[model samples]
Target: MGKLKGEYIILQNEQFYLKGYKDFANERLKIEDYRGNIEHIFSTIRKLQKEDYVHKTIVKCRTKSVPSFLGQGYMLEGCIPGYFLGGDAYFLCKYHDQKRFTSSMWVEEDKQLEEVWKKDGDIENKGVITPSIRKATTLDAKKLATFYASVFPIYPVPIDNPDYVKDQMEENTIFYCIETDGQIIAAASAEINMAYRNAEITDCATLSSHRKGGYMYDIIQSLENELVSKGIFCSYSIARALSFGMNAVLHKSGYSYQGRLKNNCYIYDKIEDMNVWSKDLSALSAGKSALSAGN
Candidate 1:
């Protein structure tokens, strides 16, 4: 009924059941970082779905729980390969509102994804010269927030808040950016879940003035290097279903399309569908990045 709500979790007998929150603006319940019995989680999902009038419900669980979740009428929305300590993580979704679960843009989105994959997947295929890419610190949060504001009029999270951005930096989010003459031009972040040995390569953006220069690819590649150094083996991204540029970058980075989440979040101006892309980042035991095929 509002912008956002408090995060809640279910703990029983000193065990974790469900850990996530209700998103009021997005009209959904998000369950992530949960460890408990499947029955408890399903009960909570039912209770909350009707209580909140949520359009959709999503649960991100590990490989072992996939069959159980799917048995509860939850469908596979996507998979984060090797996300849980070398085991895979799965995103299972249930829709309270059938209309919200179906995407009108599915046909068009499929066309764009295939088009990008055919054109190129080379990291070195640059159209313009890119500036140096570097890791961002807390000092850059304000400008980074400003940069995000310029790109997205509204985002699912409080990414436009400088304080929130700073808080994320102090936490597990590592940001990367490209500066042009001391001004932040392009940026991205690696949201690390050290417990699971996974990272989410997201928050990617480039200035309108710098779009075709391969800035995004270079910036994300730099973030990947940092994530690899931190021992992350799985990396994934959820891009807008309708955004040709976003989907193209994911394809070019060697990430394979897993599935799509429908009516997932509010981005730019309204509710939008999201396409999931994932990559299993293997350790450099073979002397090359697991994602090196795209390069």
Candidate 2:
């Protein structure tokens, strides 16, 4: 087995990620012969259990391997369409502790919140000055970390570390922040997949004092516009299932509800399900192609 900074445990063929900060384990099976390696995969899961790193196990595999994972007591959580170059990806999970599996309260909360937002009408920015929305530079890493730490106890990425946040920003990840009086009050990111022409909008956070002002919605809209201008065709987010405000943001922003991934991530000291929301931006391009063909 190989190890990467003790964060990921890489086997000969598969890899198990020990999300130490989150206290959960996730696996990625890279081999094509998933059917043949069922026993090996289970054994690796058992190893994860013995190491006391098993609050839950999330398995991300291609659509074709769903059956193999299902045979091993893994339940189908959800599917992310066009996640893999026009092919869909499926998420399966096996919860070691039954207590970790609970009904998703966000589903109902989302419906109620949607109705409320509809009745209340658009969020007013009157009298309240809007923050400047712009791309974050590496110099803003420390501020970003501070904002994230204040919002979430545990996150998938090392948001507590300014260096890690800076590195990701230097890489393909683009961070957008809402700045007021030289302070970042809210932030979000787009993980661009240039090969697939899609992007994952994630890491949305806002200071407690700055909540309910539609800053996140503005950030999402700005990010989506930037992505579309860059030739990206799809944008999606895996928002916390229990967050009424976040779900409402996606719903009001024209993103369609796709599905839910159960026990997908650890946040606020517990394993939480995630709701998938996506928007397709390829309609204009498809229409142009059809017109060109007719001409």
Candidate 3:
């Protein structure tokens, strides 16, 4: 995402990614590292809300610390399976603004959520051999930027910039794509958190004409296989709640709906709510898969 002028603090063993004020749609506090007491973290959040007016706060912590945040009025928003070494991770959120917390368009979003929830995680037949999805290298950054620019007028990140895409690849992000006649038609990526053995599947896009061809399913399946090979299988996606196509593809690929983030992101054209979906590929994890087993 585009860097905004926001407070990024690192205190001894603790770190915070406070959502930037310029990105008003996603203004919140994100606790990246919390090795100390819970009260100290909450105190910081309170101070941030009072002085900065952040609309929300999100923290990812182990199950052992869930009660401490919940007692302070934080609600469980979602879970990241296999996020810790041997334990699952949780995302707890507390809202400072009632409007940002409430979903006025829930009724509309509910219909889409229900429809996607019931879908079997199976790739629909498209009557043609699908192009193999490939792992994108830095050489493809410029083309990827051009492709993203064609699909979105605005994004939470400066994805249209080649340097930004290259920088991400150099970091922890991996991009995958489907090509037709030497042209990229659809793409997605996994933002890896190696420290936590987890990744977030995001940045999905497709050419308008190739919508129903199931290219997305291929990309997701490949991404899962890749992560599993890296010994990372805690997969989750933050999809736009109101978008049926994206949500359906994620559900059909074995992700379960955890919860929603109201006014969470500024995507495409406007600020939108996001739905959290996750899948666990570990032996102990339970979920349906549209692709082959042993992910």
TM agreement with the true structure for every prediction: 0.90, 0.76, 0.86
Taking the tens digit of each residue's C-alpha lDDT, what string does model 3 give over 116-187?
A: 877775666578788888999999999999999888876777888899899999988999999888888999
lDDT of 1: 0.80
Ranking by TM-score: 1, 3, 2
Model 1 residue runs over 4 Å out of place are 1-10, 14-16, 121-127, 283-285, 288-295
**Candidate that beats the other on lDDT, 2 or 3, i.e. the better one:** 3
Look at candidate 2 and give me any clashing residue pairs: none
Stretches of candidate 3 off by over 4 Å are: 1-7, 13-25, 51-53, 283-295
Candidate 1 Cα RMSD after full superposition onto the native fold (Å):
3.5
Candidate 1 lDDT, tens digit per residue, 82-107? Answer: 77787777889888886887788889
Clashes per candidate, residues 3 or more apart or on different chains: 0, 0, 1
24 Cα displacement, candidate 3 (Å): 6.1
Cα distance off (Å), candidate 2, residue 164: 1.5
Q: What is the TM-score of candidate 1?
A: 0.90
Best by TM-score: 1
Give the alpha-carbon lDDT of every model: 0.80, 0.70, 0.79
Off by over 4 Å in 2: 1-6, 9-51, 103-129, 194-197, 284-295
Candidate with maximal lDDT: 1
